[model samples]
Target: MHVVTTPTGQIGRQVVEGLLRAGEPVRVIVRDPSGLSAEVRERVEVVRGSHRELDACMEAFAGADTLFWVVPPTPRADSVVGYYEDSTRAACRAIGARGVKRVVTVSTAGHGIETNAGHLSASLAKDRMIEETGVSFRALQATAFMENLLWQTEAIRHQGAFFWPQPADRVLPVVATRDIAAKATELLLNASWDGRGGVPVVSPDALTPDGMARVVSEVLERPVGYRQLSLDAYREAMIGHGASEAWAQGLVDMAVAQNDGAYDEHHRTAVPSPTGFRQWCEEVLRPAFLA
Candidate 1:
């Protein structure tokens, strides 16, 4: 049996679909079963509760050989790292108790290079916690997700621009969430690999913010631009959008770390993932913008 957490999320949903398509028996731990698609509801075993709860994890992980883990975000968290530990603490215990053999988790790139990098640091700590359980683990160390730009759809639609704290000229590695899910699905299905390691799921694009803007402009058939926001402005913007002060500050720190080349080491050795920036913009962003 294969178990998935956050089954309704962007990547998790795709992972679940891939597993089902492969004829694997799947189970999912979800806060709301209603969030799952009708097809997913009909197909997989649903353990309705937060994966952070030991009871929920224990129930869902029973008789499961492989597990797909993704820590859901908590934007209002008072302490970013504390929230990650709290969220994964139960699953760590459950993984050992339930005897789930293989584990696949969505994690960030920048494992060794990032310190105090808010969300990135917290994610790495989660990876360590899971590794301590001694289950065969594969950390899908992904770069910035292309889907993250979907959050700026309105800005791109109305203002013909997008914003970020990163420098316009600094090339950043990015990947489509579907590509990440595909990699996870492949690992989950094989069950042949053992031990622990990080898999880099970085795309081939060497695009800076300016380069990304140019791609968007071409795809959208308009003069789209990229604007660099000050760190203070970025933090305040996050807070204004309902994130806690610590969470907002953590985002700022993550941006600072990325700017300082947290993912540089991994990017250097990465075998290019399939999706290109222009391809993603054309397929994903263009439709979202037009909608």
Candidate 2:
């Protein structure tokens, strides 16, 4: 059995779909099975439970050969690092106990490039804990997701500009989550590789926030521009978006790390995924904005 966690999330859902399409025996651990579409429901065995719970994961992981693990976002957590560590610890224990052989987990771009990088650091730490379980593992290290831009759709449509905490001229490697899912599905379905390593999923061209805005403007046929919001303002905006104070501060720290070249390792070794920023803007962002 191939097990998946957070199977209804953005990347996880795609991973599940890709696995099912390949005619793999799949089981999903979800808190609410109702969230899955009817087609998905009829296809896979559902173990209804949260990944955060150790017993739940143990039950879901039983008889599983490979596991696709994606930690769902916890914006309201009191401590970002604590939440990641705690949940990963649970999964590790479950994996060891259930004798699951392989795992492919969603991780951030910079592994050793930066320390104290809030979310990135936390994800790397999670990777280490998962490794300690002695399961064959692969970390799908993804850069900034293009889907992040969806949060600014209203601002782009109304004010003709979108805002970010980074410098307008600073280029960052970004990936579409679908590409991450596709690569992950390949790994989960095939048991060819062994041991632990990282796969950097990035686009061929790195884009500055300004460059992204220009592409968006061209694609949407509007005069959209990039505006650099102050870090203080960015933190405030994160809180306003329902993130806890600690979580918002963690995001601010992550932005600082990004600006400070934390993702240089990923940029140096990035193998281009098929989707670029412009294609994503045209195919994904455009439709979501218009809708």
Candidate 3:
């Protein structure tokens, strides 16, 4: 049996589709099954509960040979790292008890080069917790997702500009979530050799904010600009959006760490995913912006 957590998430839904297309028997651990599409529900076995719960994990993991694990984001959690560690605790115990053969997880780049990188640090910590189980694991370490740009669509449409905490000139590596899902599906279905390691999924061309603006400009047929928002302002914005104080602060720290070249190592070594900034902007961002 193949068990996939967070099956309705952006990446998890794609992973489930890929596994189903390959004719693999799949099970999904979800807190609410009604949120899933009827097509998806009919195709896979559903274990209705959150992966963070011990009983849910134990039940979903039983008799499963491969597991697709992803930590759902908790923006309002009091402690970012604590939330991650608490959730991972149940998964580690469940994996050990079930003796699952292969585990594939969504993680970030800059594993060793960074510590205390807010969400990145929490994700790396989650990797370590899973590795301790001695189960075969593959961590798909990706940079920021191109889909993240969708969040700025309204600003881009109304003001012809968007803001981020990172320097406007810094060359940032990013990947498409589809590529991340494809890679995860490949690892989950193959049952190949893997002790414990990371696969960095990045695009071939690095993009600066100014460069991103150029692509958006060309795609939308209107000039768009990038502005560097102060980290203090970004933190305030996050908090205003309902994130806890600690979570907001962690995001500020993450921006600072990225600016310091945390993703540089993996971007240089890893083979790039096919989607580029221009392609994603044209295909994904353009429609959303128009919508």
Each model's total of backbone clashes: 0, 0, 0
Q: Once all C-alphas are superposed, what RMSD does model 2 give against the true structure?
A: 1.1
Residue-level lDDT tens digits of model 3 in 1-291: 899998999999999999999999999999889878999999999988889999999999999999999998889999888988998999999999998888999999874534778989988889899999999999999998888889898888889898899889999888999999999998987865779999899988788999998989999999999999999999999999999999998898888888999999889898888888888888888888888
The stretch of ten residues in a row with the least summed lDDT in candidate 3 is 108-117
Structural similarity to truth (TM-score) of each candidate: 0.98, 0.97, 0.97
Model 2 lDDT per residue over 1-291, tens place = 899888888899999999999999899989888999999999999988788888888888999999998777799999878888988878899898999999999998875544578888888878889998889999998898889899899999789899889999999778899999999999998888889999888887778998988999999998999999999999999999999998998899898888988777777777789998899999999999989
Write down the lDDT of every candidate, Cα atoms only.
0.92, 0.89, 0.90
For candidate 1, the per-residue lDDT at 167 reads 98
> Per-residue lDDT of 52-109 in model 1, one digit per residue for the tens?
9999999998889999999888899999989988999999999999999999999998
Residue 218 displacement (Å), model 3 = 0.9
TM-score of 3: 0.97
For model 1, state the Cα shift of residue 15 in Å: 0.2
Top lDDT model: 1
Say which candidate scores most in TM-score: 1
- Decide which is better by TM-score, 1 or 2: 1
